[model samples]
Target: MGRTSRKRRSTLTTRMTIASAALLLGGGGLVAVNVYASAQEDPGQDAGGGTRQQAQQQGQQRQVATIDCPDVGTSLPDVPDGARGRVDGELATLDSQITEAYQRLASNRTAAAQDPNFVQNSILGPLKDKRGAVLDRIGQDIRRSGGRPPQGLDGMAPCTGRPSEQPQQPSQPPSQQPPGQPSQQPSQQPGDGSDGGAGDGAGGDTGNGNGPDASDFVDIKSVQPNVAVPRNQRAASRGTFTTACGRNENGKFNPDNVIVAPGVSNGAHHMHDYVGNQATDAFSSDDDLANGQTSCRNQGDKSTYYWPVLRLQNGKDEADVGADGGGKDQNVGEIQTPSSVTLKFDGNPTSKVVAMPRFLRIITGDAKAFTNGDANANASWSCTGFENRQLKDKYPICPQGSKVVRTFRFQSCWDGANADSANHRTHVAFEDPRTGACPGGFKAIPQLVQRIVYAVPPGPGFAVDSFPEQLHKAGTDHGDFINVFDDKLMQRVANCINRGDRCT
Candidate 1:
């Protein structure tokens, strides 16, 4: 199926109290609680001491900008029939253009992407920011008409929590870095047609940084499952499979390779990074990945895992706004990546998960994020658990019943042999949604689906992280993953997933 638009059911407005990104914790270690206090002990004599009293006084001294937004007046612009379709069509078209902008940025070198002025003026100004204007209009019309506005757009992020609660993540696993240092971003650029290279990380680039892992901020309880997995079902002939491929703290934003399949280099035109397995790349074999170290909770599970990189940029950065849109010296605003990204094994909301065959290539999202379906824009953006068949908004606020989730499902009907194919996709096919099992020619295996959730809300100043060149925007938010599970280990996962065991 191709990308399609749907009517809004509910949405938030654009009003916001803008604040500095620095004030937010961005997911760091909790501040240590002071246990001892003394009123007269070195009140003024100690320079190393910031007494609890002094700290509280200083906090009081700082002025906090607060905004209490009133809901828009009930009166809404009456919409003529077909107006929604026109806006939907416009949004679909802009989706393509904005994707291209991110692709162009990914194709460029890091220096060019980070050049500041050029990135803002050339890419973001003309492409990303412009696309955002259209999204803003779409959202406003939805609001005025009493329809649900799209989430993830310029003004549609949720406003339920303080932005400070959002997370800022590092590109390397938390184990490698010291307490509070971000790993050095690789200087190498993409499009090695001559620019630079994916660059060798063999010895020094273990991708270590101080920022907390993106998953740290997610309070598992905040989002609950709306889909009910069947309590019991006929077991697959093959054992079940499941793996808690924890979110990677070291995934990089490498866009030039395909992490969703083998032999299809650059199939995903956006960006993604891999972790868990030390040696995951386009050409990596299943064995190579299984032997690699894992950052997942389970030590025995050396499954290679990956997802898109999210960033947080302060609003003051001169380079935040692009093109001539903001005019001269006008600050563009704070840029934020999605608040969360997650992965889970699930079934179609109505059926039980079956075992998946080995070498199945499942593409969960609209690889193209559009119907044109050109480079795997099979994009899927949702606010809850596994209601993937019901893709609606271009971006959605994390719905109350679920977290802001993005899921990727692979084809499970494997051809029985050939771990991979030249095309990188033909080896596996989708199952029958109704039966929850693979069709005639192929047998069923565990259904693998990854759900990535984010925390950006309905207020102002949150956007996806792009190469400075792409100029932060929401459509640029995307993710992908490829599995090269060891043959025997594959059976173990199948056993785990089908046995109804929640072993994270």
Candidate 2:
């Protein structure tokens, strides 16, 4: 933070290439796929698991001078020593993970290995999500330390590993002689389990056990840019329209529905909590949202607000029995529960906008947040007493009377025409927090911000349940919304946004 003291950050980019490959490619398994995974611990680790590793990493960093890379100038990465070291170590560790994956292939092979989402989101998704949260925290630390965090991962490590044209079969039969490489074993074919999918588990990437190089992969997806914003700071008051949504602890429900990732079956393998409009689930029609109960003080507003459920696992809660190494891990230690959550939506600046279209579906949180080790996983955590405070850990433990919370902000800039994008994004953008204004090419729509406070009582148990794909990633914690408001109600809020008036 203090000028970073040294200049060795650039070398990390090269190293990150390996980390990124392992993370994006799916835990060392070499494919990116989202599927159900049973609880399995790293050979030697405890429940405090991922974050616990981070806390311990604090003391072991090698204080070397930063190196200079042509792309990264002389400045250190916009990260603190603690977090920088953690990511650096993880990147370096990924090389060995890939090797381990190769070793495991010698014993068993499943066809699911061919699917990228399977390993990426299931086996390794939680791992990378946890790591991404820390990386996200590192950026926050940079900002808190008075450093200007960079916007993207350019010049950071490269992750370009792509799958070969076809899954690789063992060159030698199981009984054939091969002293160096582990003996090839008969592998499992596809459709091995009841989760409902075909996976032959084709044994792929059978190299000399050194594992694939980071360069072997390709950047399959795009990364989100960082938008610097103040903590708990009020808008410039330039836009007169303002709205507040309330917190509902027991208000989480799925409605057996989903729209964001439609046909994914209920929209979530995990549960979500809702506040604003009570009945906005996947199956809810406009009438359902219009007639639903209101959590906010105003009975007139029915905007929907929802996110993942955080269940306490003091070892007795049935909600978190199998969740190991997470907040509720007993055999292992417990992970951190985010201090509090904030959910809000903002309108575009520069120009006034009318009501949002009927049945408009807006998604701001990163679906890959909890599953990928990308920059978007940079989630912020804090407490109520010092709402502006940002914690570097998974979640901060709040002092007496204050609750932990997670803040979720929706994109405020609309395309001026389309209500949604094919990907649920691109149609809208974020307003500049520094100026409270929308960037050019985007029309400022109403901004919605929701803060979820976890008022946990004094106790020894603290756990939060997450979607299975998240595998209990703290930063993967996100929310979704669908504007199912009646035409009349939608017009009222739209009018307030256009007239520069506040709505409660």
Candidate 3:
């Protein structure tokens, strides 16, 4: 059977129960599910009988991975003027309406919770199909725009309180109001607590709504300076670094707060900011990010070590995802390391960090390309080896002397962290535990990390069969995959590539 494409929508429908009902019942209601039907032209369907149970089931089908934040500096190609304007206009209208509904929901909950007759109420039922349509429309917009900005490659939008539709209010002045009340308050009524002020939602600035601006992007350039590489920790030259994969000795996952805010402890700060970072969710180490610098102020509580950190300077004018250099770039270059480089081992503060990048190359493609670290997990390929290897291992296996390479041609579909749900590529890292280096495997590599892919011309009597299939595949060891952190050789290689000559 042919594969089925995933269905997407612009707006999402959410069911909320008034807190007053929960308080009266002495417990939360059937909040596990919310039911909403389609906006049918027929008004009679609205009155049809059905318990909340059926509606709850429909919600299950709509659950999806949380949308991620967009890549900083990643810019979408110019959209057609007409389409762009239409999308912008529609979004503004939807955003305004949703904002209003959110206010009502907040107010109703506050009032209902204080009232004695508060019954379990589902906003989704009252808000109706409009909520779902909005979510559907937004999702569709992202998909239709070639998965570019506004939607963002990561689908990272600031969503709140199950999206809603405009509410119907009484045409006449509310009877419960005080005597001599005006029909409506001025547009800027401070006393009207209708819109939950700034505190209700998280935004960039107070005036423009707290959505993501270009500045919110965590650009490599922005964070590069903060990454401190003391002379001892620096590669003898430039463009090289080391990497290690290990676990927290305490046998506890490092919370998101500790990962993003390196100086802060886990319990000291709010954890929301670090939710989408790779170090917290995938690898579980700060050394990988903060340049071999782990957040823990104390030492030897569990385990920590110095990983690799590279310093690169390239002046290539490659096209990037962003108009400004905030997104992915096609310009490729490398950083060469000095003969002697030291990585600071955080565990043994006295010891130096290990590893450096001696080679550099860059290629573009989906999983078929050796350069696709974690971007191409679903693309299929046939291998010459792997007869007895366990399916558990996620890479191809080779006999003593066999090489592997992709057989098909596919367009480059690198989505970075946006399409992380279906990724298959793995990064390489040295697994140096206190006892010894992890066997066969190095440390685990993630898509979030940076790497280099170089090309080596076929040599005389170069037997492809002599290579391991794992290394032969697009990203394996043999086929031009090298760590850019190696300063000594990679720096020269980068310069050579730029000068149109091979590194001597």
Give model 2's TM-score versus the native structure.
0.48
Against the true structure, whose TM-score is highest?
2
Lowest-lDDT window of 10 residues in candidate 3? 460-469
- Cα lDDT of model 3 by residue, 411-440, tens digit: 111222211111111112212222212224
Per-candidate Cα lDDT values, in order, are 0.36, 0.39, 0.22
How many Å off is the CA of 410 in candidate 1? Answer: 3.1
RMSD, one per candidate, in order: 19.9, 21.6, 26.3
Q: Write the candidate numbers in order of decreasing lDDT.
A: 2, 1, 3
lDDT assessment of candidate 2: 0.39
Using lDDT, give the best candidate's number: 2
Worst 10 residues of 1 by lDDT: 62-71
Write model 2 residue lDDT over 238-260, tens digit each, in one string.
Answer: 23333445555433444122444
Q: Candidate 1, 129: how far from true, in Å?
A: 31
Q: Kindly report the root-mean-square deviation of model 1 from the true structure over all alpha carbons.
A: 19.9
Give the Cα error of residue 480 in candidate 3, in Å.
19
